[model samples]
Target: MKQAKTPFQFMAASTLTRICGVQATNISELLEQLRRVSTDSVFNHTFQSLSAYHFLTEGFSNDFAQWALAACNAPQMAEQLAALDIRQYESVEDLRADLVQTLESFVAAEPQRAQQKAFEPFYFCEAVTVTVPTDWRAHNLREFCEALWHVSVHSIHYHFVSARLRGPQTNDFSAWMEHSLGLPELADRVEHIDIYTNTLERVRQLILDECIPWVES
Candidate 1:
């Protein structure tokens, strides 16, 4: 059965296709997502929260800074948000308001400031997915499973960043991998693993063992 179309999934899909020629399901579907980043309240709040995290931590924490950059979704906004003093806002609400105001003013200042990049997702996906070990893509089952695990990690990052920017998501890496990466049987295998009951290593092993027949076929 075709899964129900979700507002958020389509929201993400439309944004990606319009900007990078990529969709949540495939790189070919080029529908325009109706939601614009500038008007997305949740995204703005994510930006504010991430900025505050960076500012409160004094930008000394690489992990916090990276999340802020991901939340920003653009180099220009990341640099601009990094320079702002978020502590002065005193509360998360204040900080968010200020962040939104600043972003709104920035948008007003330059209406044509390359807004096409707002919905881009592939670059972020590739950036996060590349953290896998160099040899993890070997043809062996163990390596293949490790590679799939890396892809799952990448999907988690992608979901996190997108959720922060777009709100909660109803999709998973399994369907995403099959639709976006063109790996159907592998995706079905991945979707069956229970991350809640099993450790990541265990889940990876399960996927590998289960996928052997698929690979052979």
Candidate 2:
């Protein structure tokens, strides 16, 4: 295996979730808060919630959609919110705008639904992420696969899911593979792993399933 020009450094992150002092009891209030809340709050509820709710085989993958169904008694709105593909968004602002628009459109069509109060208020929150470099560094494909097996699920989420919001590339692993190792085909495969549907551990397994064969070849 050829050594990478720039070695891939494995990193892990721990999230500290804090209440943002914003709460919404209905669709209208939720839309208001969505517009004003920080990008971290939007990212926390949508992208970060995926890891927390990864075992979900049905329904929505995000907190807003889940809340809309369970709390607000709005199944159609829930479907609309859940239908948002997070991958299409490059920034949390765009995601937030879409979220706001989804709710606005839904309310406009069914005006009565906006005032329907939830069983419990949806409290806005933000993630305070602290990332640290791990000891594992991979200079080649084989070492990269080895590191993948041992790194924590947090590392997988940090490098794969959360990385989308941080850079131009889809994820850290694909960027390194394509740019540093010159394996664009493999990089494309790794970049397509669905984070919304699988657990972090499952995501790790999927990445390994893609890379291990290449390493062995």
TM-score of each: 0.26, 0.95
Clashes of each: 0, 0
> What's model 2's TM-score?
0.95
lDDT per residue (tens digit) for residues 1-217 in model 2: 8899999999978788999999999999999889999998998999888766656656787999999999998988899899888877778998999999999998788778798888999999998888899999999999999999999887887788777788755788999999999999999999988877777788889999999888888
Error of 2 at 46 (Å): 0.9
Candidate 2: the clashing residue pairs are none
Number of the top TM-score candidate: 2
Q: Determine which window of 10 residues in candidate 2 has minimal summed lDDT.
A: 50-59
| Candidate 1: worst-modelled 10 consecutive residues by lDDT | 25-34
On the 0 to 100 scale, the lDDT of residue 109 in model 1 is: 66
lDDT of 1 by residue, 1-217 (tens): 1222321131111111113222322111111221222223323233323322322433322222233355334455545544544323324344345544545555566555524443433221111112222333333333443455555433332332233233322224444445544566666666555433444345546666775665565
Q: Point to the candidate with the largest lDDT.
A: 2
